[model samples]
Target: MEMKIGSKSNKIKYYFLVPALTVLIFMTIVPLIFSLGVSFTNYSPTRIGSWSFIGFENFIRTFTDSEIGTSFINNVIFVVVSVTIEFVLGMVIALLLNRKIRGISFIRTMFLLPMMVTPVAVGLMWRWLLNTDYGLLNYFIEQVFGITSINWLGSYSLAMPSIILVDIWKWTPFMILSLLAGLQSLSQEPIEAARIDGASNWQIFRYVTLPRLKNIIFVILLIRTIDCLTRSFDVVWTLTNGGPGLSTELLSLRIYRLAFKFWETGYASAVSWLYLLLVIFITTRFISYLYKQEF
Candidate 1:
């Protein structure tokens, strides 16, 4: 009777888990398999019913294609520059807010408002603000510095910087929130010990606080890098549509154009797979760092 009851309980538990497992497999695994299969084929809208297995040709083209290469370079720059700025700015803001001050709660809430705004909305808002003719930004610049209107999104030299600036504005709050949480949760004992040892404020931060927060910092970096690399589409699409002659064409945007605009489905899938591999490689490195820090 005891053995029978244990078997019954195990069966009941498996029944409860089956639906969720099935859903995961259907939703994620199936699509991934389908896309992987498509990546090797010569699939496109133009080839309506006729398609053939091209097997690595698309993959080869992805690496050799100059446009894709440029876009990948742009993506690297975007990840490094934007993440660095956000981390620094967010860290400083987090440090400042960690202090006891009047209206601290209100200020912290206000700082998060930008992140709360939808990416598309943020892009549109910045678009109007940065417009050349009657934009508020150019208007202020002219009033303050006697400079003429600047073409922010139209100029090749300025367009990428403009996109980076907008990204920094929208995402810095996320870094602040993550780092602030890490800062608050840190044990005060180490900090106190450092202070007791005649360590200056900078010395305490460099030696004690930073080391303690390393794991949290790595986690934040991993999350932000993945998010920024994968989901940079919406805002950038809204702002420039990879615009002004592909000046700001990120890898994600480039994929969008290949898949949707050019209708090069198979090639796009190949490029996407390569891009996915790149992200997985970088994320794996960060996870290794995290594990090292843990041990």
Candidate 2:
């Protein structure tokens, strides 16, 4: 009788999972499989019923297209420059915050406000501040430094850098919070022993704190890199719409333009699949290196 009751309870639990599994298959699995099929066809939404398979033509074009190449190059530059700055600045801020200063909690909260704001809102707020005329930033520059108003978003040379700046501002807080948590969780015995050995602050950090924080650092880097690659659409779209002659276009924006603006759904699907593969490849490498370091 006890066995029968236990079996019935297990069956009841399985029945409860049925709805969730059904939703997952329909919402995620089905769409993914459908899109994979669409990527091999010439299925322009504008053409509706008159679409057919074109083998690997779309994938071939993705490799040879100059515009895609340019967008990819721009993305690489953005990721490298922005992530580097964020890591450095975040480490500094995290170190400072780890100290037992007065009002440290309040300061940490204030530092995180920029990250809590929505990306589109950050873009819009910065857009106004970066305006050439009568903008707050320009006003301050003119008053404090005697510099003329500069067109931040309108220039080809400055457009990509401006986008990077916005990204850094919005994301550096994540690094700070993540690193701070790692620091707080670390066992204090090693750090205390390092101090007893007459090690300087820099030496203690270099020898003790950093090595322990490696796993957290790797995790945050992977998360941020994937985010910058795929989900930076709102901020970039709002800031410049890939303007200044595609100077600030990312792969996400490129896919958007191809799919919606140009109505080349099949080509867009192919590019998106390639983009997904690139992300997966990078993530796999990151995990592999992390495990190697651990072992």
Candidate 3:
């Protein structure tokens, strides 16, 4: 009787799991497979009712297209520069806050306010603040340094840097939060021992704290890389719309313009798949390192 009851309970568990698994497959796997199929074809949405399989053509164009090449380079530069600055700034802030200072809670809360705002809202707010004629930033510069108003988003040279600045402002808090949590959760024994052995602050940090925090740092880097590479659409879209001659066009924004604006569905799909593969490659490498550290 007990065996029979156990079997029934197991069957009930499978029954509950099936629907969720089915939904997951439909939502993620189905679209992925469909899009992969579309990437190999000449399937422009503008020309309805007729499409043919043109295998590898779109993929070839993705490599040859100058605009796409420029966008890809811009994305690489954005991810590298922005993520590096955020990590450094975040580490400094996290270390400062890790100290037992008064009102640290309030300071941390204030630091996180930028991250809490929606990306589009942040983009809009910065857009206004950086406006050439009426922007507070330009106005302050004019008043303090006696310089004329400088166009931020409108200028080709400054457009990409401005976008990177906005990204750094909004996302650095996330790095602070992650690194702070890692710092707080660290076991104090090694640090205490190092201190008792007459180790200097810099020495302790370099030899003791950093080695211990490697896993957390790697995880933070992985997460930030994936997010910045794939989902940096809203801010770029709102701020410049890839203006100033595609100076700030990220891969995601480029993909959006191709699909929606130009209706090149097949080419967009191919580019997106290539982008996905790049992300997967980088993430997989990070995961491998993480696993090595784990074991």
Candidate 4:
């Protein structure tokens, strides 16, 4: 009777999971498999019923294409510089907010406003603000510093920096929230002991606080890096559309151009797969570091 009841419970649990499993297979697994298959063929919608298996040609192009190379380099710069700035700014703000000062709660709430806006909305809003003519930024600069016609998004040198600045403005709050949570959860005993030992605030933070928050730092960095690599499409698309001679084009924009703009579906699919592999490699490295630390 006991064995029969256990078997019945197991079956019921499986039954409950059947719908989710089915959805996962259809939604994620099926599309991934289809895309993988398409990556090997010279498939294009324009060629309707005339596409053929090209076998590694698309993969070869993904490696050798100069535009893809440029875009990849741009992505690396974007991920590194933006994440570093966000981390620094977030840490400073988190430390400030961790204090029990007056109006701290209100200030923290206000800091979250930028991140709460949708990416597309953020992009649209900044695009207007950064416009050379009739822009608030240019107007302020002209009034304050006698500067005029600063083309924030049109110039190759400034366009990438402008995008990075906007990204920092939007995402720094996420880092602050994460770091603040980590800071608050940390035990006070060590910090107090360090304070009693004639250690300066910087020393305590560098030696005690930073080591304790390592896990949180790693987690936020990993999450942000992956997100920037994969989903940073809408903002860049709406902001500059990878313009100014591909100066600001990241791999995602490159993929969009190949797949839709140029209709080189097979090549785009291969490039995407390579990009996924790169993400997987970085993720694995981070996981391995965590595993080693645990052991």
Candidate 5:
């Protein structure tokens, strides 16, 4: 009997994927490896001759450093508060726009405008609008409440909250779009059945609508939480540059400051690694939840 070569042929088939995998490894794995290695040493490029292995010292410093401590706490608060507000506002917008109404398509498209704008542009535009001297925001506030020259981004107490407000303004549309898509995709069979079974609107929504929306809501929370943590650099940096005394310092902006401003590359690497770990943890949990729902 002739031995079939099918097993050998099948084993070799994966060779075709090698090139793409090689590129992926190069693009992602290499930087990760380099960053990981650098985190164990003082790898400042400007002080090449002074570099040396420091092991966990950088990580220790990250915990002990008062600056990092403050930034971390502030970042956590910002993420929680901003994400909560954004999710609530997004749900409202999604509910309102989910109905069959006149000019729905046009309104939906218009609502998406904020999400489509570049983050840098959004930041700059808000920066102008939050200017203490002449911003439109303060202008209206003064006109309505009879105040003048309120410092939106300049006040230390208000700086962080101001940035959070900006984040919500720019990103609420993201939440809205996701929720709207989920709402649109829901089946009406159960909803109609609930309505016929003597369910009130609030009861139908609470029992029928929100239950079906749990998975999507979880996904959106995970995604938006990560974005709120990492991609906040543009709005925060442009609006306050992590100032009003580090009040607006987020993880991303903190990392940028360490890496570029201070040129403490190895220390920055350690911080970057921490950021990566947080992202990985959040993403893993999200995927696990999704899988559990699927099963």
Candidate 6:
């Protein structure tokens, strides 16, 4: 009887789990291997479902392409600058709201409104505001500020910045929320101790606060880095579509164009792999830095 029950339980467990494992292998593992395999080939709709393996040629050419090179450089700049700006600004806002100010919860909720809005919606809203002709921004600039209408998206110089502006507006709330969680989770004893020791706000933050929040900060950075790289499609696609002659062509955007626009599946696969590796590398370094986290 016991053996029969044990066998029945084992069968049920396998039955329940096998479907999920099969889906994983088919959806994730298989696609990854296929994509990796396609990265080494000349696969495209034009090729009639045939592949000619050219080991690393796609990667080599992608790196060597000057347009691609420029895009890669701009991607690096965007990641560093945007992430830094968002983190710092978000930290500031989170700190301000952490105070027991009047109506602070309401204000915190308001700050999160931008984050709650859809990315595509955020892009559209910003696009309308930043439009050079009759845009609210340009109108304000020309009429009230006595400034010329700026070509925010059209101009190469301002396109990336415009993207960053929209991103910061949408994502700063995320930073604030993450840091707020960190702040709320901190034990009050150390903070109170610092207060009693005649430490200035700056000193307290520098000594007592920042250290404890390291893991939370790193975790947010990790998540936001992945998100900013992968899920930036709606904002960039709606705003620029990697336009102004590829001035804002991020890696994901570049991969997208390669696969869809240019129909270079192999090349797109290569770009995707390389970009994925880069994100993983940066994230891994940060993860490793605080691998044995206290939290």
Cα lDDT of all candidates, in order?
A: 0.90, 0.91, 0.92, 0.91, 0.87, 0.87
Deviation in Å, model 1, residue 86 alpha carbon: 0.2
Model 4, range 240-259, lDDT digits (tens) per residue?
Answer: 99988899999998899899
> What TM-score would candidate 1 get against the native?
0.95
Give Cα distance to truth, residue 137, candidate 1, Å: 0.8
User: Taking the tens digit of each residue's C-alpha lDDT, what string does model 1 give over 30-127?
Assistant: 98888899999989978679999999999999878999988888888888989999999999999988877999789889989999999899999999
Top model by lDDT, which number?
A: 3
Which residue pairs does candidate 4 place in steric collision? none
Position 280, candidate 6: lDDT:
85
lDDT of 2 by residue, 95-204 (tens): 98997899988988998899889888998998998888867988999999999978889999989989999999999999999999999999999999989999999999
- Candidates 1 and 3, the one with greater TM-score: 1
Q: Write the per-residue lDDT of candidate 5 for residues 30-85, one digit (tens) a residue.
A: 98899999999988988848888987999888888888778888888998999999
Q: What is the per-residue lDDT of model 3 for residues 69-186, given as tens digits with 9 covering 90 to 100?
A: 9999999999999999999999998998897889988988998899999999999999999999899999999999999979899998999999999999999999999999999999
- Model with the higher lDDT, candidate 1 or 5: 1
**C-alpha RMSD in Å of predicted model 2 compared with the true structure:** 1.7
lDDT of model 1, residue 62: 87
Q: Estimate the TM-score of every prediction.
A: 0.95, 0.94, 0.94, 0.96, 0.92, 0.91
> Candidate 6: lDDT of 66?
85
Q: For model 6, how does the per-residue alpha-carbon lDDT over 108-202 read when each residue is reduced to its tens digit?
A: 89988998898889888888998888689888889887998799999999999999888888888889988998898888999899899899999
Better of 3 and 5 by lDDT: 3
Instruction: Return the clash pairs for model 2, or none.
Output: none
